[model samples]
Target: MDQVEKTLNQNRLVLFPADQLQPGERKLVKVDQIEIAVMNVDENIYAIRNECPHQGISMIYGSISGTMVTSKPQEYQYGMENELIKCPLHGWEFDLKTGRSVFSPNQVSLHIYDVRKEDENIVLYLRRSPEKVIVQDFSCNHK
Candidate 1:
């Protein structure tokens, strides 16, 4: 049986082709040994970790909407459309652009990653370099 494999260490990961995502759409991807969410908000690229800080649930799968803005008691306004994602179970709204709590803005936040559409691909920059692996079979050459 062939048990050898080749691996490339990388500092970046391409989630998918840029054209696959349209404005206001998002995709979940697992690459570079991590799960992340890539989103296209008005043609802008945004990426974040999929886990919710509060409950360890899939945060990217939550509903996308704008957070509520207010002026006074009983007087409220909805703004920043498509910039917030509400948790499916807890209803905790998080800012997609800033990865912070929409209202609290300090109590909690998500891990945001550096992402961009480059060379027709959506690339995520990893914080650490991945280890490269290659097997050197000396017996094959000597025997």
Candidate 2:
């Protein structure tokens, strides 16, 4: 487990495991004290930081639907669901793919990780400030 930086590098990280994350399932992974959300989008996998940049809320427990997360508080009275992770306090919508918030543009975007499949094993790569953090050795036999 190494430290992931802000720039993506191909050789820095290793493949953890190859497991298809089905829809509606949440995968919690840790990379150097950072909790990441490994979500399953269709047949592919995507990773992003679990914390929301708006107010530091865990995105793993936020509103998740398909590939979109709601950061803002849903207006149930106005009928707002399947929108985005609405922060539950302020109301924001972050696109799952780009980790961009619809509410705030200048705000920092969610840290996105690079993921790829290697012979049925899922490998993730993250860019750190200095170097790349590679997390191999994920126990796929546990569950």
Candidate 3:
């Protein structure tokens, strides 16, 4: 077998059948000590942490929407259609592709996992670290 196949066979955790998941649907799964929310958007599969960072609420029941941008007053732009998942408690939105929070893109984010399809099964690979946290400099310049 190849390298990917070897890794899959070694650390792959099968969640469910690929055909059972439909577009715009999410499934909650527990592997080891982590809770993951597997989502299907327009036939693409994505997985993220099921707990919200703010209130520890379940993010599986969160709503999905497109990214909304407002340049100025009365001007609104909507892009990245069906790619954002909003927290159910405080309405915090996170990008499904990168797991970056819409409100605080540089700081807070979710633990996104890498998913793959293996012979009709949906598999989740084990990550070295459960979550990736990035810290940015917040200094200001005075002129």
Leading candidate by TM-score = 3
Instruction: List model 1 lDDT by residue over 1-143, tens digit each.
Output: 11112225435655556777777667766544566777777787887787888897876667777766767888888788877777777988888778998757888998788788878877767656534322111111100
Task: Extract clashing residue pairs from model 1.
Answer: none
Lowest lDDT sum, 10 consecutive residues, model 3, at 134-143
Model 2, which residues run further than 4 Å from truth? 1-8, 11-16, 65-89, 128-143
lDDT of 2 by residue, 1-143 (tens): 23232333443344354553554445677655777766654455767787878788867666643333445676323222343443445556676667777666568577778776656666566545423233422222111
Report the error of model 2 at residue 100, Å. Answer: 1.1
Better candidate by lDDT, 1 or 2? 1
Question: What's model 3's lDDT at 47?
Answer: 84
Candidate number with the higher lDDT (1 or 3) = 3
TM-score, cand. 1:
0.74
Clashes of each: 0, 26, 0
Kindly list the per-residue Cα lDDT of model 3 for residues 1-143, writing each as its tens digit: 11222363354566667876667666766654677887777888888888888887887878778877767788998887778888888999998889999989899898788887778777777744223222111121100
Q: Cα deviation of 44 in candidate 3 (Å)?
A: 1.0
Q: Score candidate 3 by lDDT.
A: 0.71
**In model 3, which regions exceed 4 Å deviation?**
1-10, 70-74, 128-143
Q: Residue 26, candidate 3: how far off, in angstroms?
A: 1.8
Pick the lDDT winner.
Answer: 3
